[model samples]
Target: MTFWALIILTALVTAVFLGFSLLRGRDTREPAAAYDLRVYREQLAGVDKDLARGVIGEADAERVRTEISRRILAADAQMQAQTAQAGPPVWVTITGIALVGAFLVGGAAWMYNLMGAAGLPDQPLSLRLEQAEILRAERPNQAEAEAAATPAPLPELDESYASLLNQLRETVAARPDDLQGHILLAQHEANAGNFPAAYKAQQRVIELSGDQVPADAYSHLAEMMILSARGYVSPEAEEALRQALQRDPRHGPALYYLGQMMVQVGRPDIGYRIWTDALRNAPAGAPWADAILAQLDELAFRAGVFNAPEIPAPAISGPSQDDIDAAAALPPEERQEMIRGMVNQLSDRLATEGGAPEDWARLIAALGVLGEGQRAIDIKNEAMEVFAGNAEALEIIDAAAYQAGIAQ
Candidate 1:
């Protein structure tokens, strides 16, 4: 009400001022014909003076005087005509002022209605935050989200693969305590888009692992639950993520899902920070890297980060299969020497400028293959320190360490 009152009041004041201006009588500017007449009369006087001074010949002076006289007569007639004319009627001025006032107020309201939320109440920052919190707290849970989700079409399976999958499921069902059977069931179920079944099998796997469960177990559980809910991160999924992060603080899947949950809860600022950090430390072809890159721009915009830093592409490192094949063709001693030289070059580069997790893993594996167990252990420890806050990198390093038979 106050907003409308102010707008109407301003328009009325403007209109009233313009009305007074219009009613203030005729214009005071001198008519053009009147000024012209005065100038012609002055010219006639100048011609007479010139004739008396004998500055011009009598014939020329006479011609100038006659011309000036003719102009003076024409100007006098025009001045009289202008004086006889009347200003517009009072009603016409009043109608014009009314039209201008209507346009000012009406046009403004119309334009605003088109461009703005016309009747919506003002939503200040604090109020909006409160509303968001309420929404987050009241949002649907896992089962409810899943029930509301549209079911995706399952992929068609080959006959032999389907038969094997059925046999595996039956075997897992018959032997609930079989850890490997449950793991295979979970993997196959997830591949078949049967997230509910996959997560159930994963839950059994986690149970079978007892206290020795790894972070990836919980991360996989959360991933399945989220997929079951059609990408909605429910409270159940969040709890699973929490467990994953508790086991490994920098777990990639958990962090990715947590960022997604933050966005769903109207906290894109936190989401943006989490995703950017995750992407920065992520290795090439990490599952979540592509997903993060796809939505990063919109997330940054929502987080009010207009000039967000450019996202770095995931680094590809390590020797290619071609390098291995080329080295394989050499004699034993030559091959060993060539491998040593390559390892030294990689080590020097890594020492001068750090490389990706893949590079560190490759170095560790190469040292292990070269029977340099102690060197592999040292490189693994250094890689751990370098990627202390990155769980995915640590996992890669750990796998390489295990292959090198140096895992602690």
Candidate 2:
């Protein structure tokens, strides 16, 4: 009954719209035919007024009046000719409107009957849900299926690193309750590009930490899962990301990955919103910030949003490899001072400009190589805090710290 009522109402509205349009088309106001004659008549009055005021002599006024009068006669004749040929016959208009109305109403009804379920009953919510369930069951998750069919390859490892990994696994097996050990193992495995092992290690980290686990731990687990699957966000990975965000609402990596997941699931608008906010809040030159900025224009276009947030990143300057090489030729004392100076410059820039994960790693390594182990440890702690939820970056920086002998 409601459907029929809607159809009837739509028909009435369409009819009213057509009626109003037709009435407007039949406007009675004639076009301006003797416009030039009226203009000339006004000018003639102005000329008379000017003559009474002695603005022009009578002879000049007479000449202007004659020219104006001739123009007026020509315009009047044109007006009469236009009036004779003015409007289409009223019957033709009525016939055309009838045909148009018939096409609009009859064509719409015909199309509905032919293509739509015109006679069928309305689908209820429960029926729609059942249909959706069937469709979903019939369709497998393409990303998961594809990933399962073709697993991602692990990076090749050197003998020493592989031996170290074996030893680490044995240690974890020996002392399964060591939360820090599990965290370290996860970071090492991730740095080695063994994401499946990294995922399992991070799971162990979560289990060891229990309810007190940090947001980055969960985010790290999610990252490992995604990496393991070659960037597919599986259901388990999605849940991990949710847990990360629940722990820390502004978790940058979680937001970045969630935006990616949203785009994969065909919600580019949501993805664009998530990424835009992430970009705004992300540290300048941070890996995620760079990634977000690089893809933002395409995302905005895809999402049909005209305005994406424009955040400016400050310029960052650091010592080049050539500078370091050149400094090696100086005397020991000069070299120490020069390296210290360079490190200080980098540290100051990062403190003010907000640099990338690699920059932080570089600073940490420089400090450690300079025999400032305590400083390296402090910077590592700060980098971990700042780059929370950025598992890839943290893993890389952790490796740099290990190389620099930043305390276990």
Q: What does each candidate score in C-alpha RMSD?
A: 12.5, 13.1
Write one digit per residue (lDDT tens) for candidate 2, span 1-408. Answer: 565557656875786688667666667545464567778999999999999999999999999999999998888887777745356677876786677677766776677777878668878867855664564344334356445746667678767657656766787778888765676578668867878788898998789786898788899899888877777666678789999999998888899888887776666778899998887787655556666777889989988887877776533536543345434443466456646866898999888877777788878877765778988999899899999999998997898799678757
- The list of candidate 2 runs beyond 4 A from truth reads 1-149, 312-408
lDDT of 1 by residue, 1-408 (tens): 666766778888898888888777545446788878888888888888988998999999989888888888888887777744367776898899999899888887787667867557889989978887898888999989989999878889767657666877887788889876677678668867899999999999899999998888899899999999889999888999999999988787788999999999988988999888877677565657777878888999999986444445544355533244334433466456645766787888889888888788878877866778999999998999999999988998999788767889
- Global lDDT of model 2: 0.75
- Residue-level error in angstroms, candidate 1, position 235: 0.4
lDDT of each: 0.80, 0.75
TM-scores for every candidate against the unseen true structure: 0.58, 0.50
Which prediction has the highest TM-score against the true structure?
A: 1
Q: Which runs in model 1 stand beyond 4 Å of their true positions?
A: 1-107, 314-408
